[model samples]
Target: MPKLLLLEAMGNTGEYILDAARHLNAEIIVVTHEDVHEDWYSPTLKAKIAEYGKLVFADFSDSEGALRQLKELARAEGVDGVVAGWEFLTPLVARLAADLGLPGNDPTRSLSCRNKRIMARAFTEHGIPAPRTVAARDLGEAYTLVRSAGLTYPVVVKPSEQSGSWGVSVVSDDEELADAFVVAQSHIFQMPHGIPLDPHVIIQEYVGGTEFSIETVAVRGAVTPLFPYDKFTTGGAKRAEYGHTVPAELDAAQVAVLQEAAVAAARAVGITNGVAHTELKLLPDGTTRIIELGARLPGDHVVALMRQARGIDEARIYVQIALGQEPVLTPTADTAAGIRFLTPPRGGTLRSVTGLGDCDAVALSKMTVPPGGRVRAPGDNDSRVGYVILHADTAAEVNAAAAQVLANVSIEVV
Candidate 1:
């Protein structure tokens, strides 16, 4: 059996990857910080690892030390491939794979894919159509950059290294910009691994249009764009993703435009191997602008949606690519799927979630937080209480059904 090494298997996508490994009949080893494994890993993931995989410890806080220790493990265990389970460790995975003479992305430019500040510069240097962006270390610097660039109101402020829309805000004026800057700079270190973030915050001109995400799989520098999906987000001071509809309703020309831009963005980030999740906006004039890209699989149960909608196993494809095997990307079905999140109306102690089981269109529903658990305000992805996944024969059917399912669901919070 081929041996695969996974770094930090404790996110929304981790279990899906593990299931893929199991289905592939591969021996899997998980590398994670001991503290994080104990504190952050879900009960289900822990059980899965305990039953089907081996757990190894590493200190991710020190990059050099972690790399040396991981290299030693790779050699000792005869590992076939290295893959990341979280965004923060993707750069490390690239470097480790390159060091071991395995197939992976370019180590020199991997950080550009992981850090927003570097990503903006990469897009600019590569002439990729993206939002006008600038990084600032302080509020005064942010204001100065905005003034110098003649940026208008409703600019976006976000952390350079965080994901899941944490500390991301849209400001309409100077006072709001100051507040947003502070929020953006709040997290200097990521969780679980204590990986230090780029202390700077990014301020970018907000692109206006319908947002969508396209997943691409790159095999030894060959880029193949997968399905493009519609991203439904809540509009306010903070953008919280509410749902996603697979195989978004777009004409062939529009799909081609997004695919072309997505491929270019992936190339710009030096994604020669593995998968790239690219987000972009389709402007009113029929032009597409890149939002950001991750050299990893799409999150928020997107893998599941893809499989249900198109009969494509993206998780398995990712594992096959990491193992240096040819991926099976042929679609086996032509359906549609969607996932809608359930959030409390206000931040408080959750009591009960009613009417979920009554939704016939919902294929599955799972609550991340337990009863009496505290839920955050509907702002970022973290505030999501649970999610429901639905499937139908078409995108329109799935979307409408998902909306109806959400309409019947109610959360009692006090």
Candidate 2:
């Protein structure tokens, strides 16, 4: 069995990875901070580790120190591969894999996969079609740089490195910029490990269009961009991802356009031996803008959705890629699946959610938080109170089923 070191098993991706690891019968070593393992890890995650793996705590806040400690553990444990369970720790995982001479992406260009500031620069250098972006350390500098770059108002303000759409905002003018910049800069560290983040905020020219995501798999520099999928997000000052539909309804030419852009961005970020979850926008004129790429398995339960739609187990493929093995990327199914997040009308004490019908297409449906649980408004990914997964014969059918659920559901909050 291949021994794999999984960095930070915290999200749904972590659970999927663990399941894949068990299926592959790989020896898994999960790493996290002691505090995080106690406070952030779920009981189910802890149970998974207890069943077939070992857990190790490291101070990820100190990158160098953590690297040293993990290096020793990896050597002693005879780890054959390294995988990133959290998007924030992709860089560290790359560095570890490269140092150990294992299958992984290039360490030199790995930050482009995680840090938006560095990723913007990398995209520009590669001539990837992306939103024009400028980084700012403070609001004063933001004003200077944005104006100097000839960027107008209504730009996007986001932290240099973050997930879940946290601290991401669409600002119209200078005052809005100030507010958005404060929120962006306040995200100075990542959770579960307290890893320090780049304090710069990225001001990007807004690209208006339909947004979609393409999940890509690569091995030894060979990239295979899969079909595009619908990535739904709320519109307003804050963009929050509400749901996703797999096997996006697109023509052959349209899928070609998205696949071409996705492959370029994945290779640009050094995804030579791993999986990438890339987001992009398709303009009315058919042009596409690469949003960003993550060098890890996708979160938001996209793994499960993909498996249901295409019968491709991306989490398993990720492990195989890390172990220097070729993955079977063939589609075993031609169905479709979608997930709709239950978003409260506003933020308050959750009272009750009703009207979820037991439809045949509904594969899974339940509330993540119970009644009386504190729930935030639909601002970011974390604000979701529950979700429903549905599968059907086609994308249109799946989308129609999800729409029915959305239309009938009522989220009551005090």
Candidate 3:
């Protein structure tokens, strides 16, 4: 059995990775903090990891210490590959693979994949189309840089190193920049592993356009682009994602344009061999600018939707790429699928959810939080209490079903 060491098994990707590993007949070992395993990990994840293989505990906050321990463990257990299920640890994945002499990204520029400032520099160096950005340690610096860089109003402010649209806000004037800066810099440490984070906030030119995401699988320095998907985000100051639809409703020519940009962005980030989840915006003038890209599988149950809609398991493909095997990229199905998150109206105690059974096309509905669970305002991915997954014969049908589901469903918070 081929042994793969996975860092951080607490996110939505963990279940899909474990299922894919089982299908591939590969042994999976999860490395996570002991305290996190005891406190924050859900029973479903714990049981899934336990059934597949062993769970190794470590301190993710101290990268150097964790690297030393992981090296020893890898040597002792004869680990074949290193993969990370979490986006926050993409740099760690690169470092581990480099230390093990395995197929992976370049650790020298790996931080660029996770930090927006470094990412902007890499994009500029490679001439990849991306939003112009500036990093600031405080509000005063941000104001000065915005003026000097000629950045106009309606700029985007977000953490230099965060994902899922957390702390991301679009400000229309100088008066709102300070509050946005504070929100972006509030998160100093990542949860579960307590990994220290960069406190700098990134101020980016607001790229106005339709949003989409593309996943790429690379093996032996060759990258293969997967099907593009339409991304939907909430409008207004906070740009939290609302849902996604697979096999994006795009013509052949438009798909080609997006794919080319995605491939270039992946190469610009020094992604030699691995999976990359890239988000891009298609401007009204037909120009596409990369929002961000991570060297990991996408979150929000995207793998499942992709599999159901296209007969391709991205998680399995990611594992194969990591193990130096050719990934199965050919799609056998031509249908469509989608997922719409159920967000609360406001921050309060969850009372109940209703109208979930009204849609016949609804394949599954999962509520992550129970009744009386305190819910935060709809700001980011964390505010989503549950999601509805749907499938249909056509993209239009799938989108209609998702829309109906969202309309009918109601989340009651007291």
Measured by lDDT, the strongest candidate is 2
**Model 2 C-alpha lDDT per residue in residues 350-393, reported as the tens digit of each score:** 99999997787899997888999999877898889999999999
CA shift of 365, model 3, Å: 0.9
What's the C-alpha lDDT at position 187 in model 3? Answer: 85
Error of 1 at 107 (Å): 0.4
Score each candidate by Cα lDDT. 0.92, 0.92, 0.89
Q: Which ten residues in a row have the lowest lDDT in candidate 3?
A: 355-364
State candidate 2's TM-score: 0.98
lDDT of 3 by residue, 1-414 (tens): 888889987788988888888888889999988898888778988888877779989898999999999989998888888889898889988999999998899999899889988999899899999998999998999999999999999999999888889999999998899999999999889886788988999999999989999998777777778878989999999999989999799888778888999999988888998999999998888889999999999999999999999999999988887777788789999999999999999999999999887676788889988999999999898899999998888878989899877888889998
Q: What is the C-alpha RMSD of each candidate to the true structure, in Å?
A: 1.0, 1.0, 1.0
Off by over 4 Å in 1: none
The TM-score between candidate 3 and the true structure equals: 0.98
- Check candidate 3 and list the clashing pairs: none
TM-score of every prediction relative to native: 0.98, 0.98, 0.98
